[model samples]
Target chain A: MRDASETEKAVRLYAGTVYGIALSHTGSKADADDVFQETFLAFHSSAKVFHDDEHIKAWLIRTAVNMSRRAVCGKHRRAEELDENMPGGRFEFAADEQNDIADAIRALPEKYRAVIWLHYFEDMPVKDIAKALGARESTIRSQLMRGRERLKELLGKDWFEDE
Target chain B: MNKIFEDMKTQAMPDESTVNALIESLPEKPRKRGIRFSHIAAAAAAALSMLTITAGAVSDWTFSFLGDFSSAFGEKTEAYNIVESASYSNSASDMTFELVGVSADVNIFRVMLDIYPPEGTEFTEENKPCMNDNITFDFYLLNAHKGYGASGRFDVLSDTPQKMRVMWTYSCSAGIEDREIEFVAKKMTRTKDENAVNTDGNSIITDNEGSVIKTEEIWYTRIKTGSAPQKVKYEPGGQAIDLDRLPDSDERCRIFVTSAEIGSMSVKLNGLIRGDLVWRDSTFTAVKTDGTPVGLIFSGGSTIGGEPSSGLKDGDIILLFDDIVDPADIASVTINGTELVFK
Candidate 1:
């Protein structure tokens, strides 16, 4: 483990970033809590060497995505078992003015949502996203293209930034 | 689209309590594998604050966990240095969390810590303590050079719960240079063992509780590792014994135990295996004259204590154990695979 102080600083600095990614993936605050805790703790306990803060941030984001997938799968299983007792829907969007965009994004698949979140929200380059998500650069480009196309259909033709 | 996603930034930010909880829970040990940070989602706070620590005699009960670890890995691990100074008890709960055993070879480090649950806590059913739901403790090199790939566990807890003492043993890949290390084992949750058949031959695990435990989900214990203070000491003895024709040797492969250095608390098997072996992933069992086990067998590459060993095509394998015993008492040592009685 690197110095505990450094880990603490990472948590202080990147908790929001990790938390936001988890929220984007799982769309639940409780699930976000678990995923966020897991990502930072994994970062803390991991012996994986990092080149810089950006590398650590990428690792945290990837780990968060992985853990969020697990949480989402588990939530699905529990929901299946509990059946109607569980709330079922797209991403549990907050009551905000951005609900239109949230609703539109929620209509996309998890893959598109992930690429869209990282590409548009986090502004991570396609190469960095590939490294973080363990996907090929070409694959990320395709997914970003498809995610943008899907979003354009939901929002409108003018929704494109460079259209 | 960028403007829309940017507006979602404020919505994605984690609350202050979440961040605060992360900070409060940390400065904790560096347990790597995500067994659910008990401190993060831990229900009750540290229970040791109410309990006062008092001097209690270090009983033979402490060493019971050595048998537990032996049973867990299904190996015969010898023990020598019983770090008695590592033993401590709290008078408040009548609970004792003590470091009872330590077995270390060149690259493997195994430790057993015993916990005597307080009265009224449901720690046992028909006298067999259940497996820990999750056990996490982090040990790091304090004064020495940095090491890598050291995995920790709260694995294999005590099967014998007389006086309601439960033990957990965690083994990590620690090199010889990491002789002096600090253990930061904190939170562990104990629940009924559904799969734990009688590890010790006598007890048949017919605990109907697992069929249904309505009272509590699991007992979460906070071992006062930092608050309780004592220096645990281990001295490796110079006794060396060699064995002939190691087990699981094929025509293409040969495994050798060059020297079995039996120490006060551990026997470090310094040996190398030449060529590929028939079976290298079995267990090392040191059955005593009484037909019980007391040794730990760990597998490693050719690197012993991180130094590259030449002349070995395959790598090195280590047979480790606690409980000091004469070579005569060891009925046999099974290494790699199969059995061989050392004379």
Candidate 2:
């Protein structure tokens, strides 16, 4: 029921968030592109109306998570390791550091990586992140703590201390 | 890490051309018109067709029934055997309710309806009208048939800011034999200023918790159940269970394991407990040949003529399992300690 103009506005506003979640979850641009297209098509066709910008964002995030999970579950796609060449890999940080951090995140399990991306990268609070991912806040906290520890080990002591 | 995300925000978004292309592919929005049932009656029919097309394009299958209804009835136009179709307009609530179609058979009676609200109406969690608590449909047989009355619950096939498409299914004690059915809606209330909450933004008022604060004027509508133009028999594939073999249990009065498709199973149950108690997620268990327990992924059902958990009489239930990788792998299903084995 969302008009084209409203949908365009939504795409302009949240395309990065949706694509970022998909890319972070799948670790591949091809899969990310598929998930991105599906997510927006769903938004345009969705019957549920949004209350505010926050609800729209949350719904898109939730849809992205669900689509990413389905994409992973359906097939055995080749998972490319996150590196300097990956989409969104070239950050403000040094090349090696960014690659290392990205690799560390990508190496984590899907559950942990999802929580970490939503929590640290997206700046989402634990409660909202839990709602978005349809998990308990406690579960999100647990995953965040464990994911961070795993990142610390992967990034080494010096890199960890710098944070 | 934050810097990485900021960079991701800049680089990961889809380009403008991709967004434009996607927008171009979507169906154009229907033009806004006066709130009249007759005006959008044809649009509602088109919406039903669009529902099927949309379901196929989108992967989310939550509303698959809408698509199924369109395909199953559209082709055999005469198979649905629609009994009646009625439209009502409530100027006070600025809403229109139409009984689009109704079809009945020996076992099941189904009703399809479309509710059109004024433009700009919102349907968010806080703003969405609580259909379960506020709306009630009282169905009665006009010609004095076998059953006392029809009992069933409504499931929303699609909901938008403009219109909500819903399907109601009931277990009929007898078939429609030249008998007419009447649906009377009672005490229908909608939330007017749902966003009006406490200053802290909590929806709960200071004194009235879980109670309607600012209620819109009450409206009621009576419409005859529409007869589907044709009578279509929908037969799902899978293994059927022998009714006599189902074990005895206090929770379930009687259960018919009708079919087991690849990843899902359907059942009709009359539970022993009171209230509209449909099957719970924890009530059933499935296992594969390797003896690994399969988790119940989803369970959906509609109650006939009672409140949820008010005990079940008879209703259609669909159970989807996590370990149903292949239909051939299913070993057995245990419901309330009564196991039904499959060879």
Candidate 3:
């Protein structure tokens, strides 16, 4: 276990990254919330040593990604109605009116969505994304290519030029 | 180029309340590397490694690293060795599960496995190998069966594009013997969708296009070991009391323990207690026979009847002790006013 201060500091520093990864994977705010808590709590409980802040960040990203998938799958299998008021209450895919690019990302398949989210939103290189997700760099590269093509199909080629 | 993606990144940022909830939910104790619940025990076991190094001490129990599960249980190693002969293959998914190595002692056991997924399987977040939640098994010791309550954990020590290594370590206060371990996985939900699944170890698998990938077989394994536990015998005298038998008391409270053990990682002190008490995560001052403070270890007990609300009756109790570096030299433990003297 890490010191309380270490955990608290990480929570402050990377809550955004962890929460974003969870939110992208699960879509439901409630599930994101659950994964967010679980990721940090998992960090608090894990005895895995961290060499530096980058290592810690990488650990958090990996944990968040895996936990988010589990959370979504469990929610689907239970089929239990969540309290609509809760963040994880619904398996929602509705994008903000102002963010059609976000909607396009959401519209992609889970495999591509994850690869795309980490690459574009996080500004991570393909090599780093491959490491974070434990995939071959070639696999990540191809997934990014496919994800971008899917995005272009969804939003058309103009959005690529706009960016 | 990713301006919109960057702008909306903060939209998912957890609020102050969510952050506070996480902070509030921080576990009170540090966890061991193997098991989730045995935090204090794991933390203490970790410290044992440091103490072993600083003093330049050496023992059969002295482990340079706890990452190797096989070295932790069954028998201590002059060196770590993994037997690859025990491989079990599930042909349907082209996944082979091999029991690479195992070790067990009187109070604990460890098993290591090498999981080889199909050649084309990608290590993506969407494509994951099975975890503890996906597998269940029964452990038999001298024909006695245990389906649950084996304090253990399955951890993925390393995962790569080619292979994944998982190690499980468990402890019992009473003791564990070399026996056959039977694992039957009912379903392999490697993927959430209908794209992949297996029933037993030998089910047929199909891709999204319904192409037959591999014929799955029963993902089961039977492991037999020859080593016996190095059990320490204890004297049979401790303070005993009964309240129900007393004419002045009507409280239906009792506790009984058939065995007690103290390992380098955790302590299990099973004893009989007489009081209107429930044993769950309660605090008790613990010390070695030498007065070395056994810091942050927790003890739990159960009653004869079912249900969480029932008072503890004359039933088995197990204590998980967190920090005892050189338990080999210790002869007993003192919890509260009661002392258990081991021979």
What TM-scores does chain A show, candidate by candidate in order?
Answer: 0.81, 0.80, 0.83
DockQ of each: 0.11, 0.15, 0.16
Models ranked on TM-score: 2, 3, 1
Q: Could you tell me which 10 consecutive residues in candidate 1 chain B have the lowest summed lDDT? A: B40-49
The residue-by-residue lDDT of candidate 1 on B1-343, one tens digit each, is: 3666676766777768877787677645665432231111101001011111121223312111111111111112332222323434434333233343333423333343434454465444444333322222222211101111221222223344344434343332221211111122221122354433323221111112322111111122222111110112222223232334222223222223322333111122433222112123344566767998765534332221121111112233333344444444555555543455232
Q: What TM-score does chain B get in every candidate?
A: 0.23, 0.30, 0.26
Interface RMSD of 2: 13.3
**Chain B TM-score against the true chain B, candidate 2:** 0.30
- For B182-282, candidate 3 gives per-residue lDDT tens digits of 23322111233443333322233222342332323212122222222233233333433222212122222222221133332222333222111323323
Candidate 3 lDDT: 0.43
Docking class of 3: incorrect
Fraction of the true interface contacts (Cα pairs closer than 8 Å across chains) found in each model: 0.28, 0.35, 0.35
Q: Please give the range of 10 consecutive residues that has the lowest summed lDDT in model 3 chain A.
A: A90-99
RMSD of candidate 2 to the truth, in angstroms, is 19.0
Q: What count of clashes does model 1 give? A: 20
lDDT of 1 at A142: 91
